[model samples]
Target: MSDLTDLLTVPVLDRSLQGALKAALNGKAKPPGALGRVEELALRLGLIQGRLIPSAARPVLLVFAGDHGLTRSGVAAFPSGVTVAMVDTLLAGRASANAFARVVGAEVRVIDAGVAADLSGRTGLVQAKVAPGTEDASVEPAMTLAQAEIALLAGARVADEAIADGANLIALGEMGIGNSASAALLMHRLAPAPLGDCVGEGAGHSPEGMARKRAVLAQAAARSVATAPLEVLTQFGGYEIAMMAGALLAAARAGVPVLVDGFIGTAAALLAVRLAPNARDYCLFAHASAEAGHRLMLEVLEARPLLQLDMRLGEGTGALLAVPLVQVACALLSEVAELADVLEAAG
Candidate 1:
């Protein structure tokens, strides 16, 4: 990787269309501001596309899967093998995300960011593993700087390819059994919050399991005082989380709207924003996660999510649920008649 830091560049969204887009939205054949956040989303899409008419017709969900060695420390209710299994389920189009994507008319692609198992023979899986899996962060750094760079660059490349293939809307989600623990650690250090606040009951962990997860995360936090974005990611993030951050940056660079999923995804967004503040401009938070510390994460990013279904599933399911809403927001902005036009037609 030749100075992969340059790949993190994300140009701020162009604001030239903001005024006209707002006017057009206000002029739509409805009560002014009647659509609530839908209208706001329309304006955001217009500004992102730099046009009065934005498009969400080609939405693609990139689900990155990885494994974390921290599972060995009893941080999750499920085994790390679940990550590989879920990757297979996603590729087979049997996951909840796939079902939701089918209903919303979006494409799904599964990327093997760093699953511990060999997924070589899996059909329709994007092969971008930087390592089998990350090392246990509660003991040592999750991954070396080079591996983190590779994972981030791989994510960017995957996102760039999706955009090149005409993905107007990019939705990001991740699969890793121990990843919520990893996310909590990332948020604990990067958001500079109390570790207890960041830790949550991932996958319905028992009380004992939750306590163990918290203890392991506390250990990880005590081991690292690194607050820099990349350093924190290198210290505690999973491969899929880094890839999601990479993809977020890539979407911002391409000026595409990004629907960030739940807590894990938000943690990645936080990391991405820390890397490039302007990247936050292109992000549309899909939903507020029910997971612990998610609200704090959103607050730190100053983000208002599009939905609040009390959801904690992390496979881009929440994002897929918000896809049709984005489409409708774009459609209303582009296809709705102006109030003046409607009045003149009546005459």
Candidate 2:
């Protein structure tokens, strides 16, 4: 595992970034300040990125797909095969994320972290398989520490490669049928709350499914409480969630801004924050999702999301939608005129 302290040393803000934002805000035009959240977002982006001219280029949307053994325990409404099918749909450019990425001019990269089904010879997918599937959480641990480390490293490596490939902005998304259960489990362990509070209906589960999910997660939490955070992750969290957390850490270290999507994404951000508290500096909450646990996760992270469209589509759709808003913020900050530049002296 990489040294968490060393990874956390990246600068989150600098004078150049702040100065550029101030200059943009002071440009001649409307009132001293007219654009509210937009201007704030621009400045915040600059500060977090430590860049005078903040521009997200070659934005990459990383969708990590995996399957949880807990899915077989009747946690999710959808079957485990849905994960593989969705991965295929996403790769075929038929998913919501693909559509949004096409509309926003961003590239999408799908990684097969630990799909239970075979995806051999799949095109347009990055095969970084860590395991066939997570271990059955209802019976034993989800994954060994070694497996978890491998998955996390794969995610970090992907972020590094994306940066090398000219991707200046990163968005985290996931595709696992029972991931919300894993997320809730992680949240219950990491946050200062009860498991019931963190638990939610994942993938449109019914009341009974949610109840069973909570019960199973409670048991898993009890069994893993004695372990460290990473240990708990290896034992109970899904591979995609672990990878998403690693990606967030890598993005922070590489000085790239990160946009977080809904519950699954927020859960990863929460883990990232725990692993590297400074990583929070580079993260931007894209939106408030419709998922019940997502709001709690966002609250725990103390994030002010850009939109509240009540979206729960995961797949980084919310982040993709927020991309244009971020760009508009930058434009307003850089191009909009200040009163001084537009109004003549009192004469």
Which candidate wins on lDDT?
A: 1
* Tens digits of lDDT, candidate 2, 190-219: 765677888776668777877888778777
How do the predictions measure up, each by TM-score? 0.98, 0.93
| Candidate 1 ranges with C-alpha deviation above 4 Å | 1-3
| Distance from true location, Cα of 48 in model 2, Å | 2.7
Q: Give RMSD to native, each candidate.
A: 1.1, 2.2
lDDT of 1 by residue, 179-234 (tens): 99999999988887988899999788888888888889888888989999999999
- How accurate locally is residue 203 in candidate 2, as Cα lDDT from 0 to 100? 69
Q: What TM-score quantifies how close candidate 1 is to the native fold?
A: 0.98
Error of 1 at 95 (Å): 0.6
Q: Please count the clashing residue pairs in each candidate, in the order shown.
A: 0, 6
The TM-score that candidate 2 achieves is 0.93
Clashing pairs for predicted structure model 2, backbone only: 27-337, 27-338, 28-337, 28-338, 29-337, 29-338
